[model samples]
Target chain A: MKQFFIKNRISLSVLIAFLIFTGISFFADYQPGKAISKEYFFQFFKEMIFFLPIMFVLIGLGDVWINRDKVEKHIGKDSGLKGIILVMLLSMAQVGPLYGAFPVTYLLWKKGASVRNIFIYIGAFCTIKIPMLTFEIGFLGWKFSLLRTLVSIPAIIIIGIVMEKMVGKKDFTIKQP
Target chain B: MKLLIAFSVIAIVISFIADKRKTFSGIKSGMVMFFKLLPVIISVLIVVSIVLFLIPQEMIIKYLGEESGLTGYIFAAITGSVALIPGFIAYPMAGMLVKSGVGYSVIAVFITTLMMVGIFTLPIEIRFFGRKVSLLRNLFFFIAAILIGLFISLFYNL
Candidate 1:
């Protein structure tokens, strides 16, 4: 029990902090505080409900199905432009928040994806998501959306290269918990 | 959401067909990963809620309006970095800001940083990528957002 608690300490503290804030809000402003907290909590909870399970299942499936040797053969350190483009397309097609990319990227790293490819994947995931781009075009107009997309492609590549150089292959190993 | 559901269903079918035992083990590991991530998720949600409550839409519109200049850019970048609003909501809000006379540059900075540089998500990031890489990624994105904003300003003559 103690060991479990220790492992979960951060979560517990955050829960406590949330309760304390909610309590304070209730005491200080009563109706609005309760209403605000409830509204926000439920909104996020709904998103979690919809997305989290799918993300986990997909990660699980990827883990089980993907072969490390095959992955490494295609996208290893010397894989170059082909590997980078493949990773970019994969990330662009991804369907969740940026946080959802973490485990997937970790799996890729473990499977021996180049550090540059991993970083590029992450960078593309953050901005070039297909659904998000459609929404962006709807709201901001196609010109703005297209311009940003065009600019971001090269930007992501440059950032990936810079990050690989800075972090080096030695630091690319996934850290064990 | 429909896409996710469809994908999940397909994945389930594929997993079961390919190898039942490995699929179960995969799910078990995925559950472990989920439990490990739960705390971070809950904490981020709570923090995001509090932030949304504190910074109303009117405030964002007022501060990011055309006359706000460099201060507007900085403010937008910071708020966008910290805010956890999803892209669907964020894009519409940026649209409203644009209609309200907020500069394209400001909106660019806001949207870029909102997506790229996640301050609140840093803890989870550190957990996955380690402190150095997480920090560096955020830092690099922050700089990229500023440059992107500048590029938009020059391109559109804003």
Candidate 2:
């Protein structure tokens, strides 16, 4: 119990603060604000519950089954433009909030995927995913959405390369827990 | 969601048949990852709720055109980083902002950063990528968001 509390102290305090604020809002008669906040909170919670398990399951399966050699060959240091295209396609296929991508990203790192490709995966996952694109087109017009996609492709690549360069040849380790 | 669940189910079934021990180990790692992430994710969501309470939806809408010149664009960018509206709602809101004479550039910046650069998800990101990479990732996207806005405005009048 003590170890758990110590490890999770930051989150516990934040949770407590949330409860206190909700209580204060309840007392101060600011019902609407508190209600809306709660509504949004539950909505996101629902999304997290829906996606996280399945996403992590898939990531774990990949961790066990996917060969490091394959990851290195496809998205590794010498993979070049093909790796870029591949990561973009991989990211586009995903459907979730950005947080869900992190585990998969970590898995790819452990499997020897290149830094640039990793960043590209993240950049593409967040921005140009297929489902989000259609919604954007439906609401913001196909032209706007297409233009954004067009602009995003090169921008994502550039940023990824820049990130790789900024971090230099140094590759840091993130322990698998 | 249905499609994802279906695929995961198929994958799990196949993996279990192929090698039960490996499958179980895979699932164990996944569960460990899930529990590790839950606290940070929950705390982040709670903080997000606080943001929603303070700013509210309408206030975000209002921020788009409240200031003149570059300040309005900056405000829109900052609001995009902070606000957590879903894409369905957010895209339509962008349309509304455009209709209300907010430039496409500002709207571009708003949506780009809104999706790519999550202020609320920073802690979760730090957990995976560390402080420097996460912060730099957001910073790069922030600058890219601005440039995306400029490019969109340059390419199309609408």
Q: Judging by lDDT against the true structure, name the best candidate.
A: 2
Encode model 1's per-residue lDDT on B1-158: one tens digit a residue.
79779878988888899899999988888777777778777788777787888887778777777447777888889988988888877998999999998888889889999999999888778888889899999999988988888888888994
The docking category that best describes candidate 2 is medium
In order, how many clashes per candidate? 0, 0
Q: How many Å off is the CA of B83 in candidate 2? A: 2.2
Flag regions of model 2 displaced more than 4 Å.
Answer: A1-4, A20-37, A174-177
Residue B157 shift from truth in candidate 2, angstroms:
3.8
Model 1 chain B, poorest ten-residue lDDT window?
B60-69
Worst 10-residue lDDT window, candidate 2 chain B = B65-74
Model 2 Cα lDDT, one tens digit per residue, A70-176: 98999989999999999999999888888888898999899998999999999999789998898888878888888899999899999999999997367664445
Clashing pairs in 2: none
